[model samples]
Target: MNKILVLAAHRYPDKSRISKAAIEAFTGLADVTVHQLTHAYPDFQIDVEHEQNLLRNHDTVILLFPFWWYSSPAILKEWQDQVLTYGFAYGSDGKVLHGKKMMVMTSTGGSAQAYTPEGYNQYAVDALLLPFHAMANKTGMLWQPPALVQGMNDATDALIDNGVNYWLERLQELRGM
Candidate 1:
């Protein structure tokens, strides 16, 4: 079974609907660890070595966050900057993350229709996620299709439940259950 690590980042977790539901759904699952960044590092002082160790221990890595300004929250970016070092996440001798699988789960305030060339965002979500795909490629990790929960700002209970179910199912699949 793949040991999965979920790096959950939310600028305001308390105010979140979709992210909170997803995190709750992941609670107490076998071979799955949900690490909430804001709660763990409120001061934003990421432990690079510890983070790297966590990455090394997990067979699959899931990045869960709320889309902000068409990108992830600052802490996730900071975690990437600090933990994914040249000699660790990438470099001649950096093969620790090789063969691992990566999945990105995100929530967006806008509806699905808003993320298109003719919509308000004027770009597809997949296009906006290229950087993450590139990161996975450069780190030798297999990039899985991303899971997204759109229309977060007005998502109903049923929608939230559906998204949470999808995330839980994905995690279970990753664990080979």
Candidate 2:
């Protein structure tokens, strides 16, 4: 069975309702490993060897984060800077992640409608996340379609339930990969 690693990054995990639930639910999956970035590197000091080892062991890597200020949390960027190093991830001999699958699963405070040209955010979520796709490509990992949970700032019970279901579907797809 292929192991899946979820690098979950949230600045305030407890305050994020649906994210907390999603993290808990995904953590229960047999082949999945959910690593909370903020919890791991509270001091912003990442253990590069350890993080790279996690990537080496997992076949699929899922970047589970909140869309904070149109970007990922600080730790996630720190992770990329530290863990995805020259000799490990992208040098002449660096191909540890080659052929692996990478996915983006992010939540937004605004609704889906807000991420359109006609909407306030003025761009599609997919458009905003092209950088992730490019990152996956640069690292020689297959980029999977991103799953977005929107309007979590005012989530109803129904929205939360749907978010759970959406995550379940993504997990199922991960197993197949």
Candidate 3:
């Protein structure tokens, strides 16, 4: 069985209703490990070796978090800076994540329609997530389309539940679980 790591990096966690719902649906199911970044590093101190080790063991890496300023939280960026080193995650000898799969599971406060060509945000979800896709490509990992839930700011419990279920089903399909 392929091991999956869900790297959850939510800064303002008290406001994360949608992201938590998605996590609750997947935790403790099959070969999965959920790592909460903020809780682990409240002081912004990350154990690079340990984080890299987690990636080394997992076959698929799912970055789960709310979209902050069209990207990931600070801790996630720190993780990428520290763990994805020159000789470990992306050098000539850095083949640790070569065959693994990488994808993002994110929630947004903006409506889905806003992330369109002529919309307010004026960009597709994929366009905003190009950095991640590029990172995956750089590291030789398979870059999967992101699982996005737009408009969580005004979402109801029923909406959150439905979105969570949809995301879970998509994850299972991605991992062939």
lDDT for residue 54 in candidate 2, whole number 0-100: 96
TM-score of each: 0.97, 0.97, 0.96
Top candidate, metric lDDT = 1
* TM accuracy, model 3: 0.96
Q: Is candidate 1 or candidate 3 better by lDDT?
A: 1
Residue pairs in steric clash, candidate 3? none
The weakest ten consecutive residues by lDDT in model 3 span 13-22
**What are the lDDT scores of the predictions, listed in order?**
0.90, 0.90, 0.87
Deviation from truth (RMSD, Å), model 3: 1.2
What lDDT does candidate 2 reach at residue 109? Answer: 91
> Candidate 2, residues 23-69: lDDT per residue as tens digits?
98898799899999999999999999999999999999999889978
- Off-target runs (Cα >4 Å) in candidate 1 are none
Cα lDDT for residue 6, candidate 3: 91
Weakest 10 consecutive residues of candidate 1 by summed lDDT:
168-177
